[model samples]
Target: MKQVEVTLNVNGKDTTLTIPPRMTLVDCLRDELRLTGTHVGCEHGICGACSVFLDDEPIRSCLMFAVQAAGHRITTVEGLLNEDGSLSDLQDSFWECHAMQCGYCTPGMLVASESLLAENPDPSEDDIREAISGNLCRCTGYQQIVEAVQMTAKRRREGAANG
Candidate 1:
């Protein structure tokens, strides 16, 4: 198969690479771009482990082709941090709420929660639950994850009101 030249703007960096047409975005991120934070649990897209933001919306990278993502902005878990290397509010909430175990699902959950909060900053518990429905977690029983999102939302609201 002939490799195609593609451009990917990942985490605010524009990268150029040659990739086969069949290459999935997950493989491109992990193998080519070295953004291994995006894991491949089920390459068939059933698992949300490969979730990332495509144009600010959460999408399963495993289901998309590298070529399909050209000219678009992509944000992975690695992008969800402050310039000083501090975790974002959603990430901090995860740690404060103890929302991860084995940590395999944290990336997806974080990205999902980030998307949810971006659209609905004052999300109700039910909204949080519905937003994270696609991501699966084998630990924390989901209570902690939900709590983390809620807490982050509350903090965001507080900050907004005070500012």
Candidate 2:
């Protein structure tokens, strides 16, 4: 297979690389771009472990081709950092709430939570549950993850009101 060139805007940086047409976006981001934050789980879309933001929408990178992602913006788990390199509010909430155990599902959970918060900053418990339903977590029984997202929502609302 001939390798093709593709450019992806990831984490606010433009990265150009040559990859096989069959390469998945997750592989491109991990193998070529050295952004290993996006983990590969089932390799099938069933496991959202390889989730990332494609143009600000959460998608399964393992199911997306590198060529298909050309000229699009991507945000891996690594991109969810504060400007000062500190953990973002969502990540902080996860930590404060003890949302992760083995942490395999954390990246996907974080992406899902972020997507929900982006669309609905003030989400109900049911809404949070629905948003994270796609991302499976074998640890913490999802209660901590829900609590983390709720905590993040509350903090974001409080911060917005204060500012």
List lDDT for all candidates, in order.
Answer: 0.92, 0.92
Off by over 4 Å in 1: none
Clash list (residue pairs), candidate 1: none
Model 2 scores worst on lDDT over the 10 consecutive residues at 132-141
lDDT by residue for model 2 over 25-139, one digit each (tens)?
8998889998888888888898788999999999999999999998888998999999999999999999999999999999999999999999998999999999988888866
Report the C-alpha lDDT of model 1 over 1-163, residue by residue, as the tens digit. 9899999999999999999999999999999999999888978977688899999999999999999999999999999998898998889999998998889988998998899999998888899989889888866459999999999989989999999
Assess the local accuracy of residue 11 in candidate 2 as a C-alpha lDDT between 0 and 100: 94
What shift in Å separates residue 69 of candidate 1 from its native position after superposition? 0.4
lDDT of 1 at 127: 95
Error of 1 at 102 (Å): 0.9
